[model samples]
Target: MHVPDGFINAPVSIAAGAVAAGAIAVSLRGARRELAGGSPTAGFEDNRTAPLGGLVAAFIFAVQMLNFPVAAGTSGHLLGGALAAILVGPYTGVLCVSVVLLMQGVLFADGGLTALGVNITVMGVVTVAVAYGLFRGLLAVLPRSRRSVTVSAFLAALVSVPAAAAAFTLLYALGGTTDVPVGKVLTAMVGVHVLIGLGEAAITALTVGAVIAVRPDLVHGARGIITPLKLRVNGELVDAEAPAPDPVRSGSRRAVWATGLATTLVLAGVVSYYASANPDGLEKVAADQGIDAKADQYEHATADSPLADYGVKDVEDERLAGGLAGAIGVGATVAAGTGVLWVVRRRREDPAAPTHRSAGTAV
Candidate 1:
């Protein structure tokens, strides 16, 4: 949910900004180890995943444009930090949501650049940390099946949305520009967002289940717990001595790249046009609580850009204008995300690292 320009005061925004900066800094270093370690295919020297990470960010960006209606007026988009982390990796997932937030802030003026830190902290950090924590906890106690992984994903996403809503209420109470009681804000926000959480859980589960079924190795949440497929020569069947990971016979990193990019393009270029035309979670709460009074206008880098505000300037057709703008967003976000991940991945790749152990390319 975009907080817009006004909801939070300057002091709280600044504090959030500092916290976001520190989190992003920490995420970058963590991503280096995550991208480098625990994967057979994604080697310490592999720069291939840079493009993949970028595609994930763009995918999340496009998906966020398709808001599903939760009630009469309030809708919700995919708060993808947990889903992305489960699909990719935690550090990369954090980076992915951060990229989406950054693009929305600077390009579309959806979120405030001044409050970029706040958005990332709330949406990216909080969701990822909460989702990953719960996911790991469940995996520790449950059977290490792909189905278990998918179940955990659903539960993680379900919890993260409400947790974010609670966090927003707390932040607003600290820096609200309103005379409304904190208890009222908390009750309304949590009540409405519980419905929103169902949507989040569905998307997270479906996406994670699909990827885990195909490319379990590529799944960040499924990492370090994979049991490779083994062929029993005498028995004439493929099996595992231990608990087996879901087969990835047709799933590869290349396949994930192709599928993810295609999904992003389709959603942004075609499907986003049909998304419900209702305000999202934050917008509804703001209007209900009179939090829009101090809302300032956004100063976006793309304010003068032809494809600003998800509409192509001079395109009379609403469908056409939105379609073109959505496509542009997908393309730009993918490129920007790739560039950032490239730099991050390049710096940590040890070019001369061993090749014998990491020889296979299934991942």
Candidate 2:
């Protein structure tokens, strides 16, 4: 959940900011390895992973705009941590969610500036860490099949939402500005979020399964997991020979990217128009438990932005205004995410870059 200003006290918020900063820094470094395919020969090269990472971030941003109703008076949306971690690597996934949070806070006045670190810690860090861990564990035991990967994605996503909610509850208990009972807050937050997680699971499973069906190579988590089946020849069962490496077809990659971007545009620009208007899970829980009694306004700097609150200011048509804002958000997030990931990928490919052990020795 996006924590608005004043939900957490200044001291705790500042501490969380430090934690978020550290985590982001570490992730940036770790992402280099992930984008490089675990080793020099394990994963997609920089050219492939960089743009794909950006697209993944933009997809998350767009899907988040489509808040599905979870309960009678509350709605929930994709946090994207599980989806990102399953599609991209875990470190890149963290950066993806962080980028979305930053864009939403500064450009859209969605998440509060003061609470940026809190949102990152709970939504970005915790969700990604837990989801990826569970996903890996499941993959370890489950049959190494495409279906297993999809199933793992579903279960990991299903748990991550409530885990994030639980994290928020703990943080509030530590630094909430109000006097609401911690027990009530935790119960309510976790309760509603459980329902939200079901929707998350469905979306994650379908999306992961679809990608695995089409281009499993592009999925970081699915790479090397699904092997070709065996065939019977001359009354003996033998492993099927691996197919010849297809020549790198830039056109195929471009087509996939174009299709994904078009889908993102459709969801954010049009489908979001019909999303549930009710307050989301956190907002409803806060209002019910009085945790939002001391909630403060967002930063004044973004108050007058033309795209504040996910709508274009001064536009007479609500649908047109929201559509424009969503499109703009998608564009900005993709650009920012792509730029960051490109730099990281470039560093990994640099001949002059120091190796991990070498840097450690120098230190």
Candidate 3:
């Protein structure tokens, strides 16, 4: 749910901005460790984290356009926090979503420019923190298998949607511009988002399951859960050592990236044309509850942008205009995300060191 500018007053907006900035700074430092492999023996293959993170950001941008119908009138799309965290590390996951938000705000003009911090805090920080925290906890308690990891991802994503709704409710309560009753708003936001969460859960599970099926090693959440091969030595079973890092894996990684990018392109450029046209959860709730009474005063600063409202400004064909915008958005998100991750990766203390994790070791 992208909060518009007029929804919140200046003081609360500034406060939220400060919080978002601090979280981003902390995440950047944290990302260095994750991108560097989080261990001394991590192989160069761990370098895959950076580009994979970029792809995750672009994929989120693509999927967010596909607003699946929830209730009769409302719809919801993937927030992607749990999916990103499960595939990449949590810190990188935060950066991934943030990159998507930035691209949407600046280029597509989907989210308000002034409410950037609020969007990042609610959508980026809250979702990742809640989903990743719950995911790790569930993984700790559940059976140590790939299935458990997928289940945890599903549950975490399911809860994260309402968690984000609650966060927005709290923010509105603190500094809402309109005089709407907080109780009704809270109930409606959470209620609809719960149904949306089901969609979120399914998508997160399927994506995580698909990734795990092919390359469990690249999935950060599946790292410690997928058991390594064990050999019987004189009637006693022992954990087999991890195989040597292969040179051929680089080509394999290229293939993975190609497949992922192709999927993202198709989702945004072609499939998005069929997305639900009804209002999303937040927009519907705001309209139904009169939370956006003052939205007219604070119009989007980028309303005049060529790609405003997810369409090309002068394009007559709705489908073609939207398709071009979505395609452009995907490319912009990938480039921005990759550039940011590359900078973060460059800041590692020992860039040359291979920080490899043993097979089946917890991160």
Model 1 clash pairs? none
The candidates, ranked best first by lDDT, are: 3, 2, 1
Per-residue lDDT over 1-363 for candidate 1, one digit per residue giving the tens place of the 0 to 100 score: 877666788899999989888888987877876666544336766444577678888988898999999998889898888887777678888888999998887777677776787798889989999988898898898887888898899999999888888888888989986777889888888888789889989998998888777667667678766656778788686765665444453355667788788888889989999998899888898888877767744445456767667888899999989888888898889998888877777677466877555556664
lDDT score, candidate 2, position 206: 91
Candidate 3 lDDT tens digits, 68-127: 999888999999988988888888998999999988988877778888999999999999
- Kindly report which residue pairs in candidate 2 clash with one another: 37-43
Q: Point out where model 3 deviates above 4 Å.
A: 40-45, 350-363
- Tens-digit lDDT track of model 2 for 108-196: 98888888999999999999999999999999999989999999999999999999999998889889999998999989999999999
**TM-score, structure 1 vs. true:** 0.87
Order the candidates by TM-score, highest first.
3, 2, 1
Index of the highest-lDDT prediction: 3
Global Cα lDDT for candidate 3: 0.90
Evaluate all candidate structures by whole-model CA lDDT and list the values in order: 0.81, 0.89, 0.90
Question: Which of the predicted structures, 1 or 3, would earn the higher lDDT when compared with the native?
Answer: 3
Model 3's TM-score against the true structure: 0.94
The positional error of residue 282 in candidate 2, measured at the CA in angstroms, is 0.6
Q: In model 1, which runs have C-alpha deviations exceeding 4 angstroms?
A: 39-42, 228-252, 296-304, 349-363
